[model samples]
Target: MNVYLGLGTNLGDKEQNLCRAVQKIEERIGKIVSLSAFYATAPWGFQSDNSFLNAAVCVETSLPPYEVLKETQQIERRMGRNYKSVGGQYKDRVIDIDLLLFGDIVMNEADLVLPHPLMTERRFVMEPLAEIAPDLVHPVLGQTMKELNA
Candidate 1:
């Protein structure tokens, strides 16, 4: 299955954390198919002291979307994400891995949302996504990355 993962780090060797996350993914589920160049970005929400390093990884995986999201969260916690509440939103994570898209799937259940609800709106997400999948359509919007980016 074609899958995309969004990786971010704002603490403790951001680039190294990204590399290690890639290694772990390769060892666990699938080989990395493509990786967008890392981008240095301002924090998108919930301001913090550190700026974030962000990138996107496209991989083929047999794991289902929910399974992938679950595993990715575990990986994040293991990588030293800590939680503080900011109006009930988790904050201050060292590393974060979000399941941006799982093939063309879309589901809005209690635990997960596919095609990533805000992906199109975030320049950080869209810029990297367009690099790797300019022709990719937003499952919900039916718009290509180039269209969305525009």
Candidate 2:
């Protein structure tokens, strides 16, 4: 399965955090097929003193969605992610790795959601994602990443 992931960091060696997280993902998860350039953006959904450096990557994995989520969380913890979002508001963090797509699968559960619910609303995610996957369709929205960004 081809999985798309969104990565971001706003604290503690931002570039290094992104790179390390990608390395960990490759080491523990599966092969990385494509990666997008890093993009700097203002923090979304909350106030923050530091802006974020965000990027996206496409990985080919055989693990199921839940297993992929588990591995991603483990990677985040390994990279010093210590706090979860409060009141659905974002905050500065060492690293944030979001699973954006899993081969056109759509899932919604208490702990995870495929085709991330808020991806279209955030330029940080859409921009990097569009760069690497402009024609990748959202399984639910029925639109390409480039169209969504437009």
Most accurate candidate by lDDT:
2
Candidate 1 per-residue lDDT over residues 26-124, each given as its tens digit: 766687898999988887767787888888889889998877877787777777764533444645567888788888998998668897877877888
TM-score of each: 0.91, 0.97
| Predictions: Cα RMSD each | 1.8, 0.9
Candidate 2: residue 98 lDDT (0-100): 94
- Per-residue lDDT of candidate 2, residues 1-150 (tens digit): 999999999998899999999999999889999999999999998899999999999999999999999999898887788777866877789999998999989889988988898899889999999999999999998999999999
Deviation from native of the Cα of residue 113 in model 2, angstroms: 1.1
The segments of candidate 1 whose C-alpha lies over 4 angstroms from its true place after superposition are 82-90
Clashing pairs in 2: none
Task: Indicate the TM-score of model 1.
Answer: 0.91
What C-alpha lDDT values do all the predictions have? 0.81, 0.92
Candidate 2, residue 36: lDDT: 97
